[model samples]
Target: MCFKCCLFLASLAFVYFAKAFGGAYMKSSITQIERRFDIPSSLIGVIDGSFEMGNLLVIAFVSYFGAKLHRPRLIGIGCVIMAAGSFLIALPHLLQGPYKYETSVSHNKDVNSTESILPCLSNHSMTEADDTPDLETKTACEKAAGSSMWIYVFLGNMLRGIGETPVMPLGVSYLDDFSREENTPFYLACIHTVGILGPMFGFMLGSYLAKIYVDIGSVDLDSITINYKDSRWVGAWWLGFIVTGTLILLSSIPFWFLPKTLPKQGQEQSESKSKSTELATVAEQENFLPEENQEQEEKEKPVTFQELAKDFIPSLKRLFRNSIFSLMILTYLVAVNGFIGMITFKPKYLEQIYGQSASKAIFLIGILNLPAVALGIITGGFVLKRFKLGVIGAARVSISASVGSFCLLAIQVFIRCENAEVAGLTVSYQGAPQVSYNPQTLLSQCNMGCSCSMKHWDPVCAYNGMTYTSPCLAGCQTSTGTGKEMVFHNCTCIGEMMTPGMNTSAVLGQCPRKSDCDRIFKIYMALSVVGSFISACGGTPGYIVLLRSIQQDLKSLALGMQTLIVRTLGGIPPPIYFGALIDRTCLKWGTKQCGGRGACRLYDADAFRMTFMGLITGLYFLANMLWGGLYIKIVKRQKKLALRNQAKENGQEGNGAVNGHANISIAKNKEDEERTGEESTI
Candidate 1:
C-alpha cells in the first residue's frame, strides 16, 4: 500500500515532468529553426532559457512565502502551472499550417508577436537534406498570420515557469506532512523513487496521448506507413500527465483529510508577528519607563525580522549563532554544482562527440547510479549517527564534496567513449584505432531514438531478423576523433532514427546513425547514482534532520528565520555566472557550446579542459572541505555557539538564584532585629 501511494505520486511527478520533456521538444523545434528556418544558435538559448525566465525571483519568493502561507495548496498550484506549460509547448505544432482567417483587431493586433524572431536552430554544418521549418516566402501570406504563433508558444511557457517552480519542495513538504507516521527511511525512499519515475513515465506514457495522430507527410520511424502522424504514443504521455496530476492532487487530500491539528509552518510566524506588533504599540505609547521596571518589560518584547537580519543579533547574544549552517550551505553549493555537472557531461559529451543515441547508454548508467546512491545514503546515515552529527553536519552543505567531483572525474572517462567509439569504429574499419561503450552490444536492445517504429527502414541502418544491419553510427556520439585518419568506435547507437522508412531499427546501419539521438545513459546513471546519493545524504536527509536538530538546539522561530534566509540564497544563480563564463570561453572550445549539452559533452580540448578542470577544482572544495577544510570551521563554530548559549543560560539562572538567596538573607536579618527590639522593650 505504501508502494502504491509512492507509485501514485510518482505517476503525478511523471506527468509534471512532461513539461520538462515538452521543453526538450521545444528546444528541438528551436534547433530545427537554426537548421530549417535559418535562425542563430544564440537566439535559441534565449528562447529556451526564457522558459525559466525570471525563475529565480519566483522560486525564491514562492519557496519562502509558500511555507509562510499553505503547503498543500502551493503544491497543487505548482502542478497546475507545470501542466499549463506542457500544453503551451504543443501549441505551435497544433497551430502549424496555412491560416486563411485574419485577426479581428484593427491595426493587425494578434494573440502573439515576435514569432518571426525565431529561436535559432541547426548550424550551417548539417547537410541541406535536413528538414527544417519552411517559412512561406510569398508576400501575400504576410497579412494572414506571422511567426507570432511560435512566439505565443514561447511566451506561454515563460508564464508557466512561475507555477512550475514551487511544485518540488512544496510537494515534498506535503508528503512529509501526510507521512508523519511512516518510517523515515522507508517513506523517503518511496518518495524519491516515485519522484523520478513520475516525469519519466509521463514522457513515456504521454507519447501515446489519446490515440492522437499528427499528419505530417514527411517521415515516420522505419518508413512504415510514413504518410500520417501517429497519435497513440503521444496519447499515452498526455494520459500520463492527466492521470498523474489527478492522482497527486487526490493523494494530497489525505493530508488534509482529517481536521487540521498540527501547527502550520506559518502559525509560528503569525504568533511572533502579533507579539511584535503589541510590543511596538506599547513602546510607541510612551517615551520612557521607570529604570527599574524598563529592563524587565523590554525583555518581554518579541524578536523582529529587522533586528535579526543583522547577524541575528539577539540570537547571537543568546548563543544561538549556528556556524554549522554556514558550513552546510557552502558544502552543499559546491557539491551539487560539481556533481550535477559531472552527470550532465554524459549526454552532452558522449552523445555530442560520438553521435551515440543517449537512451541505451543512459539506461546502463542508471543501473550503476542507483546502487551508488543507495549505498551512499545508507553509509551517510550510519556515519551521521555515529558522529553525533546534526542535519547540516551529516547531510547537505556538509556533504563530502569529493564524492561528486571524483564522480565527475569518472564522468570524464565516459565522455571519451564518443571519441573512443568513433576512433575505434573508424580506426577498426581502416586499421587506425579501437573503441567500445564498455558493455559491447549494449546498443542491441536500445530503442530510445533508434526508430521507435518496430519496422526497420532508413538506409542509415538495415535490419537482420533481430537487430539492424551494419555497425552503429550513434547519433549523439560520445567521441569523434578526426585526426590523422578519423578513428571512431563505440556504436553509441547501431539502431534507428525516425526516418520516413520502415523498420527504423533496420536499414540505418554503421553510418553516422541515431541522428539527434543522444540519450546520455552515463549521465543518467551518474545522476541517478549521485543525485540520489546526494539527496539521501543531504537533500532528503537534510529535511528530515532539520526538525530533529531544531529540537536539539531548542530554537523556536528565531532559528527558523535564519534557516529561511539560508534557503533563499539557493535560487541565486551561480548558473548565470557559470553561463557568463561559458559565453566567454565556450565558443573558443568548438562544437557543443556551453549550453545544457555543453556540461555533459567533452568534444573539444578547450571544452574538455574547461569542464574537467572546473569539475576538479569544484570537487576539491566539496569533498575535502566537507571532510576537513570546511567542516573544521563548522564544528568549531557550532561548538562555540553551543558553549556561548549554554553559558548565557547558566548565567541567567545563576543571577536569578543569587538574587533569591540575597532576598531570603535580608528577611532573616529583619526578623532578628524585630526579636531583639522586643527583648529590649520588655
Candidate 2:
C-alpha cells in the first residue's frame, strides 16, 4: 500500500512537472508569439488569460464532484487533454505560410546584385502606399485575414486550462488524504520542487529555440538579414510546444495504472486490524477526515442527485465561515495578480529595459531565476517539516519571507538600465543621446534629401555608436555586403553628426548599449535572483497555511474554489491591464501585413520601468497588508480553538474524577457489609 502511495507521489510529481512545463513554455514564447503574429501585447495578454477562462468554466464542478471518483484516472485524462492542447497550439505554425518581416532591401533586375536603396535619388516623394507591403496586393489581405490564427492558440491554451483544472485540486487533495499528516508538507514540497524544474527546462528550451529562425528549414539562414537581436525576429516558438506536448503525453501513462483509492500511510496497521479506538485516535488528531473514510460510512446508502445537490451550498457556506481562509485567499489573490502579470511580460521587460536579446533574457530566467525559486520552495518545506511548525509558527515564517521579499522587490524600482541610444527614438538625429522618445526629432537637415518611410523598423548603427531607424533614414546612398554582415557607406547623417575626419559609414543592427548599461543589467539580474529566492521561500509554507486552515472534508472544493477565485480575479485581468498600460510607453509600433497596427517594437525605458515596477510593488504592498491581517486572524483562531480543546479536556477530567470517587464509595460500603456478615456467622 505504501508502495502504491509512493508510486502515486512520483507520478503526480511528474505530472506537476509536465503541466508546469507547458505553462512556462507558454510564458516564454510571449514575445515570439507576439512578433510572429504581428499582434500587440494586450492581445497576447488575452491569449495568456484564456487558460484561466477555461478553468473558470469547469473548475468548480470538477473539484467538487471529481473528488468522489477515481482521481488518478481523471488526472490522466487531464494530461491527455493538455497534450492535445499543446499539439493544437503548434498547428497554426504549420498551417501558416513562411513568416515575412518588413524590410527595405530590394534586388536589382539581375537578382544577384543588390540595387541601390537610396530613396534620396528618387524624384517623387515616398508615400504610405509605397512603403506598405501588405497593401500592395489583394491576395495579401486574404492571407492577412488568416492571421487571426492566434485564436487557435487562445483556444488551445484554454483547453489546456480546462485539462489542468483537476490536477491541482483533486491531485493535491488526494495526496493529502492518503499521506501522513506530518509527511504532507514535504510531499507537496517535493512535487512543487520538481514542478519548478519544468519552467527551468521550458524557459531554457525557449532560449535555445529563439536563436533559430522561425522558417529555418524552408529558407536559407544566410539570406535572412536580421539575427535574433532584431525586434522583428520570430523564433521557432512552435517547436517547443510540440516537444512539451510529447512530454505531457508520456507523463500521463503512469497515472492510468495507479489505483483509484489508497489507504492512509502510517495507519495501515490500525486499518487492517479494524481497531475502533486506534482509528478514532488517528481521526481525532487529523484536521481533515480522509474522503475514503467518508465514502465507507456512506457506502451502504446509495447517494441521490438531490442529496448531493442539497449539500453543495451548505458545504460552501461552512468553508467561507472561517474568516482566516477568506483573508488568506484574498492575500493570495492579490499576490498572484502581481506575479502573473510580472511573469507574463518579464522576458519582454529584460529585453527592453536591459537591452538584452529575447534568447538571452529567457536563458537567464531559466538558469538563474527559476533555480533560485526551486531552492526557495524546498527550503520552505524543509523549514516547516524540520521545525515541525504549527499554524502560528507557519504563519510567522510565511509572513516574514513575504515581507522580506517585498522590501527587496521595492528596491528594484530604482535599479534600471538607460534606454538604448538611437536616432529619433532615444536621441536626437544629430547623435545626442536623450532619455525620451520624440518622433518629430527623427528628421534633420542632413537626411532631408532622403524622404524615407518611417513605417519599417530596420535599425542600423553608425560608426559614432548612434542607431538610425534604417539605412535610408541614416542617409546612406550606398551599401555593401549582404545579410547580417552588411555595411552602409556614404552616410550623410553620420558625417554631419561626426567630425569631418571621422568615419561616415554605418553597419547593420543597432549599437550595443554603453558599458554602464551592461554593469547596471548585471546588478538588476543579481537582485532579481535574490529577490525571487526570498519571495519563493514562503511559497510552500503559505500553501500549507491554506491547506491546513480549511475543513478536512471540504479540502478539495476549498482548493478548487480558491483556484476559481484566484484565476478569475487574479489571473484573468492582470496581463490585459498590464499590457494595455505597457502599450502606452511604445516608442515605435510594428506595422501589420493588413495595414493595421501590430506589435510594439520599442518603448520608452524610464516610463516602462516606472509603470511596470510600480504596479508590482503596489500589488505586493496590498498583499503584504492582507497577509498581516490573515496572520492576526490565524493567531486568534488558533488560540480560540486551543482554548476550546483545553476546556473540553478539563471537563472530561472533572467527570472522570467524580466517577472514580463514586466507585470508591461503593467499594467501601460492600467491604462493611461483608465484614458484618462474617461477624454474624462467627
Candidate 3:
C-alpha cells in the first residue's frame, strides 16, 4: 500500500511540472492569450481543450504500447518531449536571445543569467528600440503578426497532453490490481487524491515562479527598474502560469519506477495449470476424453500483437454497435459537461465587461451554481444505490446537470450583464474589506442613505494612483439610473499576489453589496462548489459505468480499440464545437479581437441576449434530455440480454450436477470459515 502511494505521487509530480494536468493547461493557454497569438479564442480553447479530449484513449494506448516497448523508456522519452515543448512555449524569448545555448540549459536553473553572460553567442538580434522595455513582450509586435507562430503553444500542450494522459488510468489501475493482493483501496485513493492536489499546488507554485521571473530573473535581461519596496511586496501575477509549467515539467520524472506491465505471466500460468488439471479429471471420469482436447489443454498458446490488435478492433465495434452502450456514452457526455461552453467562456465574459481581474472573476463565479450541480449527482447516486439506478442513474445525472446547468448558466449570464444595475457604485476614501454588509460604508463621505453590515477591515481594491486613509461609506440605496459612478477623495491600488505585482487587492472586494451580493454570492458559490464536486465525483465512476455498459450485451466483444475511439471522439468533439462557437462570436464582435476572441467587445456585456439566446439554451438542454431517455432504454435492454446469455451458458454444464453441487457446497462451507471473522483479510 505504501509503495503504491509513492508511485501515485510520482505520477502526480510528473503532471504538476509538465502542466498537462487539470487547470494547468487553462493557465498556460491564458499565458499564450496574454502573449497575443493570431489564433481565435475558440480555436485556442479548442486546442487547450484537446489536451483532455482524448486522454482516456491515450492512457489505454500507452499501457498497451508501453508494455511492448520498455515502459521506462516510453516515460523517459515522453518527459524529454514534454520538456522540449515547455521550452518551445518560452520560444519567443529564446528567439530574441540564443536558441542553441538556451536549449542546452534544459536541466539548468541559471538559464536566464547564462544567456546574458554569453551575449556574443546570441542567435538572433533584437529589433525593438532600447526604449521598448521588453523586447520579448509579444504586445510590442502585432498580436497576430506572430500569432501563426503560436503553434508552438499548441505543440507544447499536445506533447505534454500525450505524454501525461496515460499516467492516470494505468497508474491507478496498476495500484488497484497490485494492491488487491494486500487488500487496499487506501493506496489507490491516496495516490489519486495526490493527483488532484498536484494541479492546485502546481498553480500556487507556478504563480510564485512567475513573480520571481519579473522581480529577480528579468532584472539582468531587461531594462526594468525594481525598487526595494516593489521587490519587498510585489506579486506580478504571472507567477502561477510560469511556476506551474516549470514544476509540472520537472516533477514528471519519477514515474520511471512504476510497474510497466501487469502480472500477466502469473495469471496465465495459473489459468493454464488450473484448467489442465480440471480437464484431465473430466476426461478420466468420462473414460473417453478427446486426445486433441487433452493436448490443447496442456500446451499454452502465445498471442501476437497483430492478432491482439485485430481482436481489439472488433471488440470495440461490437461494444459501440450495442444500442445501450452507445446511449450510455451519449447521455453521460451531455449530462456532466454539456454546458462546458458556458463554464469555460463565462470567465472570459466577466473579465471583459466588469473590468474584473481574473482572480476576482474566478471568485465571483458564484458558488451555488456549482452546488446545484453536486446535488444532481448525489440525487442520481441516491436513486442508483437505493433504487438500482445502474446505467439509468448515470444517464439521469448527466442529462439533469447538462440540461439544468445550461439553463442556470443562461440566468447567471443575464444577471451579470442585462440585469446589472451598477448597483450604487461609490468609491472608498479607503479600500474596504472584500466582504462588506454596507455599500456606502466603502465611501464614508457619501451623504446617500445607506446600511452598514459587515464587521471587517483590510483593503484589496485600489483605484487610480493615490491611497485614501479615511473610513468608507455604507449604503442600501436604490439607484435612479442604469449606471452610477462615485468618485473618491483619493484611492490607491495596492498590489499583492501569489507572486510579485499580482494585484492582490482584487481579492479584497468580497461582495460589492455584501448583503445582496452575499445572498447571491453564497448561493452561487454553493452551487458551483456542488457542481464541481458533483461533476468530479461522477467523472471516473461515470467513465467506468459507460465503459461497462458498452461491453454488456456485446458478449466477448473486443473493447481495447473501442476504449481508444470513444475516449478520443467523446472528449475531443465538444471542445472543438465549443471553441468554434466562441470563435464565430469573436469574428462578429471584437474591436481589438485579442487573439480573435472578440475580447473587450461591446455585446459581451450580454453575449446571449442576441436573437437566438433562449432557443440556444433551450435546445442544448432539450438535446441533452433526449439523449438521457435513449441511454436509460439501452442500459435496460443490455442487462436483460446479458442475463439471458448467462443462463444459457450455465445450462451447458450439466450431468455432474447432483454430486458436483454436494461437493461444491461442502467446499464453500470450509472456504467461508477459513476466510471469515477477519476484518482486514483480503
Write one digit per residue (lDDT tens) for candidate 1, span 1-682: 3443454355434534444444333322332222211123334344445555635446544644454445555655665665565565555554544221110011122312222210011122322232222344333333233433556545655655655565554554444444432344344544454443433333233323323323333333222211112100111112232344344334333323222123222221233457778667456544554552375355346645454355334433432333344444455555555543333333333334444433323334344544455455455545544454453454433344345535555444443323322222222322234333232322233323432211112112223122221222232222222111112222334323233334323222233433322454345344445645554454444444333332222222323333333323322233233333433332111111111121111123334445544654555455555646544553443454444445456664235664465444444434332221111100
Candidate 2 residue lDDT tens string, 1-682: 5777888889999999999999999999999999999988999999999999989999998998787778899999999999999999999988988888877764222334554455345413555676445545745674655688999999999999999999999999989888888888999899999999999999999999999899889986777888999999999999999999999999989888987767777655443555787767667755466664567567446566677678789888777766667888899999999999999999999988989999999999999999999999999999999988887778888899899988888999999887887888888876566755455567778777777767767888888888888788788888776677777888898887888888899888878887898898888888889999988999988888887776667889899999999998999999999999999999988777666578998899899999999999999999999999888877755554454445456664235665454444444434332221111100
Native-to-model Cα distance after best TM-score fit, residue 189 in candidate 1, in Å? 5.6
lDDT for 310 in candidate 2 is 83
* TM match of model 3 to true structure: 0.55
lDDT of each: 0.37, 0.84, 0.40
The per-candidate count of clashes, in order, stands at: 111, 0, 71
TM-score for each of the candidates: 0.50, 0.90, 0.55
lDDT agreement of model 2 with the native: 0.84
lDDT for position 652 in model 1: 44
> Which regions of candidate 2 fall more than 4 Å away from where they truly are?
107-125, 129-145, 269-306, 433-438, 652-682
Better candidate number, 1 or 2, judged by TM-score: 2
Q: Write the per-residue lDDT of candidate 3 for residues 597-619, one digit (tens) a residue.
A: 22212122334333223434654
Worst 10 residues of 1 by lDDT: 587-596
Query: Every model's Cα RMSD, please?
Result: 16.2, 9.6, 14.9
Runs of candidate 3 with Cα error greater than 4 angstroms are: 1-35, 38-40, 46-80, 94-147, 172-192, 202-242, 249-251, 262-312, 332-340, 353-355, 362-414, 417-523, 550-603, 608-627, 638-682
Most lDDT-accurate candidate: 2
- Arrange candidates by lDDT, descending: 2, 3, 1
